[model samples]
Structures are given as C-alpha cells and as structure tokens.
Target: SQQGEEDPQALSIQEGENATMNCSYKTSINNLQWYRQNSGRGLVHLILIRSNEREKHSGRLRVTLDTSKKSSSLLITASRAADTASYFCATDGLNYNQGGKLIFGQGTELSVKP
Candidate 1:
C-alpha cells in the first residue's frame, strides 16, 4: 500500500503546550493532507499542502512536507483538552494516471490534559 504511517502512537501533553507528530509514506504523492478525529466522529480535514508546497498553516496548526524522504510533520500549538483526538496524514498519488483516492496513515492519538 502507498499509505503513510504516523509515529508516536500516543502522546500526552498539558493544556497550552504543543504537540508534534511525524508521518512517512511509501510512494510519491501529488499532495498530502492532515486530518483530526474526535473519538468516534468522522475525520475532519485540517490542512492540505501540495507537493510544490513545503509548508502550510491553518490557525494554530502547522504542517511541513519533505518529498525527498517521503515524509511529513505536523505541529499543533496551544493545546487544549478539546484538541485531544487522533491525527492522521493522507496522500494523493503523484502519478496522474493513478486513482485520486487518499490513502490514510495509522493515526497518532493525542491527549491534551486540561
């Protein structure tokens, strides 16, 4: 599978702190996307940065892509208990002839203690 894998399967942090997670993918991709899920809820798109883009930000969230290594990193600032959730990284293949489906990584569970 050309899916990504996230590191630090679980993390614990205090409110107002920051959380960082890493992801590595198997193949080249046109773009990478980050998502967050609150428990049983569906995943919500947090940000999407194309291969041409090295970094992207959405509010307090920052994401960086490194195509050479087929990896990416996500940084979340000002943590809150409400921010506790599972974070996942996905990618759309680089080959134009390939299907456009997004492949998801095994997510990292974040716990923000208030």
Candidate 2:
C-alpha cells in the first residue's frame, strides 16, 4: 500500500511563477521520488526523499515529506513555459527487489504558459 497518489490533478501557471504539487501514500515507505514527463515522452527523475529525511532540494525544485501523514510535496520555483508537463510520485511498494520496479500514482499535469 505504498502507492502514492498526487493531488490537484491539474495546474496552470505563467512563466516565473511557483508551482506546487502534493502526494499522499497509504503505507510506510523507504523512500519516495518525483518525476516529470513532457507531453508524449517518458518520466525523468526530479528528486528522491528518504523516509528518514523531512526535506530535500535540487536546483529549482524543493520536496518535503511528513511520515506522520504519509505524504509529500514538490515545489517548483520560478516556473517556465518549458516546465509544462505531467508530474508523478513513485515508491518501492513491495517491489524494491525487482530491478527497482516502482508503483506510480495518478499524476498531476501542470501547464506553464509563456
């Protein structure tokens, strides 16, 4: 039950604005990762936050975790039109030993207009 479901199914924003997305899971997890997909392409890893850590940051992205609530959030600062894409959260979900196979959630689609 480590499946992580993202909230706010869709988001729209202008260039230079900040975008925030949230994810909630149903069980304890070893770690969680966020990914981005542009249009018809595959997902690309943005960040990974371990259960023992509360927050992490990479480039313009910030991620936070709350084990007590089994939830996490991703924040993108100063978004650009190129940032328009689908975002997803993934976890081990009992498949950790199967070549890193992961369980993904329904994603949040973000649109950034220039």
Candidate 3:
C-alpha cells in the first residue's frame, strides 16, 4: 500500500512542551499532507510537501520528507493544550484526482496537558 504509517499510537505532553511524530510509507507519491483532527471535528489541513521538496513548516509545526526512505516526520515546538489533536499523514498519488482519495493511516492521538 502507498499509505503512510505513523509511530506511537498516542502521546501525552505537558503544555509548552514539544511533540514529534514520524511516518513511513511504502511507495512513491506526488505529495504528502499532514492534518490535525480535534476529537470529533473534521480533519484540518496542516501542511503539504511535494516529493521534490524536503521540508516545510507552518507556525509551530515543522515537517520533513525523505523520499529515498519513504518517510516523513512532524515536529511541534512549544506545544500547547490547544495543540492537542490527532495527526495523520496522507499521500497524494501521482495523479491529482487519485491524490484526493486519501488513505489515512492509524493516527497518533496527542494530548497536551494544561
């Protein structure tokens, strides 16, 4: 499968702490996207890095991609309770339409203690 797999089924960190999550995939992809899901809420797009790009960042989030190894990592610096949410990585296949049919992995549940 071209799906991405994230490590650590869950995580808990104190407010102001940093949290890191890693993902690994099995096939080549046009791009990879990271999303945040708050409990029952819908997933929110966080960042997207193309296969040609090595890294990208948004606010307190940093993401890195290594196509050779088929892996990606997400880093949240200075995490807050508000930052607590489930994170997932999805692959955008070679085709745009195909990419839209995202296959999400078992996410990493994050809890930020206030």
Arranged by TM-score with the best first, the candidates are: 1, 3, 2
Give the higher-TM-score candidate: 1 or 3: 1
The number of clashing residue pairs in each candidate reads: 0, 0, 0
Error of 2 at 19 (Å): 0.4
The residue pairs in collision within model 3 are none
Name the best candidate (by TM-score).
Answer: 1
- Assess every candidate by TM-score: 0.94, 0.92, 0.93
User: Against the hidden true structure, what lDDT does model 1 obtain?
Assistant: 0.93
Better of 1 and 3 by lDDT: 1
Q: List model 1 lDDT by residue over 1-114, tens digit each.
A: 648989989999999999999999988788999999999999999999999999998999999999999999999999989999999999998777766889999999999999
Off by over 4 Å in 3: 96-99
Error of 3 at 92 (Å): 0.6
Q: What's the lDDT for candidate 3? A: 0.89
Per-residue lDDT of candidate 2, residues 5-110 (tens digit): 8889999999999999999988767889999999999889989998899999999999999999989999999999999999999976545677777778899999
Off by over 4 Å in 1: 97-99
Q: Report the lDDT of model 3 for residue 6.
A: 94
